[model samples]
Target: MKEGWTWRLPCALASALLLAACSGGGARDNPDDSVLHQDIASGRAGAEVTFDGTLRADPQPVGTHEHLTVTTPAGDVLEVDHNTSLAPWVPAHAGDHVIVHGELYIDPGPRAGVHCTHAHTSSGCPRPGWVELGGNYYE
Candidate 1:
């Protein structure tokens, strides 16, 4: 009986080690490498781009920050930081399509924001003063 228990303990330890090895590390440990590895490898890091996608509004705030999800035409999803004041402007509907223009801060994670100086868009892309964040626009 003692031998059986000892053998089982070794098996359990080995199983745990194997599981740990397979799991590896998490995103928190290497945020930059985890987030921008593909972009860096592809050499498309600094390209100014416009992505068209339907918006997905989060049910709850993300990390104490207002979050907006843009599902690109190619089906790629981008999580954006709408900042503070812009939160009120976010569209309530999840399916609204929008074209966001801003520098893609890819390293830490893909995030874009239109500053308070940018003009609001009643329809189409933002024009020039204080643009809203997630509001639905007809275009």
Candidate 2:
């Protein structure tokens, strides 16, 4: 019985290590915004994306979310829906450059945008999201 327990101990440790690695944390090493651009072009939604854009307008209150319209350097306009309930409002204005990380959601007209931009505390948000403006990070 002692010998069997010893053998199983190593297996248990190995399984825990693998599980820790698979559990998501931090952002991927996407150096450029090309992947995000591709996601937009392909009309893919529900993907975690990060990119920089120029604020096209001031943030507006839409329910619990602070809505922002930003234009990517590549000429694509993206809506950034930061959940004010989960995070603080970004003190940004039109023409301010900003960095955004969130889950993408595509829809017709002005409904398409990114959401879930907040800190992740559980499985509901697989990847943590945040907004960076004027050197301040909001999660």
Candidate 2, residue 128: the lDDT equals: 73
In order of appearance, the predictions have TM-scores of 0.41, 0.73
What range of 10 consecutive residues in model 2 has the weakest lDDT sum? Answer: 23-32
Shift in Å, residue 44, candidate 1: 4.3
Off by over 4 Å in 1: 1-47, 57-64, 86-88, 108-139
In candidate 2, what are the lDDT values of residues 1-139, reduced to their tens digit?
Answer: 6768988998999998888788644334332478877888888888888888899989999998899998887877888988888899999999998888888888976345888788854365677788888777888
lDDT of each: 0.45, 0.81
- Per-residue CA lDDT of candidate 1, range 50-91, in tens? 444667764246663455676665555666554434334454
- Each model's backbone clash number: 5, 0
Using TM-score as the measure, which candidate wins?
A: 2
